[model samples]
Target: MRRIPILVTLLLVAACSQESERTYTVDELIADEALLSRTISDCRNNPGELRNTVNCHNAEAADGKLRLQNMRKALGG
Candidate 1:
């Protein structure tokens, strides 16, 4: 009786919680510099929590690729 209402309330609360954030791929992050910067900033700001996340990994990869590209361009290669 009372348990039914409690269960319903719990279900509603769980459903209203924040949805999981979608992760970006390395290529996607590379194509969006602003997003890449923001993601890197976020991962650095909360490293213990986000360092191992997919978004953080992709952001780091994208940053590496961009830096390598810049270096190549600078050397006229």
Candidate 2:
């Protein structure tokens, strides 16, 4: 009885803490752009292999693009 309640509470907390395709504010998107750029640039010289694919601007851009699109829609632009 008590254990079940505790388990349910834990599950609720975990779910709330998880991110679900949350959109970022414009400021956050801009900051992410800078960071992502730097990551790719560093990869160019270092050629970490993984860095090129990971930071060469695909995943982050896609995510940011979606968020920006959502923001634009929400703003009725």
**Candidate models: Cα lDDT each:** 0.97, 0.61
TM-score: model 1 vs. ground truth: 0.82
Off by over 4 Å in 1: 1-11
Q: Which candidate number has the best TM-score?
A: 1
Please list the residue runs of candidate 2 whose C-alpha ends up more than 4 Å from where it truly belongs after superposition: 1-49, 54-56
Question: Count of backbone clashes for each model?
Answer: 0, 0
lDDT tens string, model 2, 1-77? 89999999999999889585333444454567665565546556666554545344454564567678889999999
Clashing pairs in 1: none
After TM-score superposition, the amount by which residue 22's alpha carbon in candidate 1 deviates from its true location, in angstroms, is 0.9
Candidate 1 Cα deviation (angstroms), residue 75? 0.7
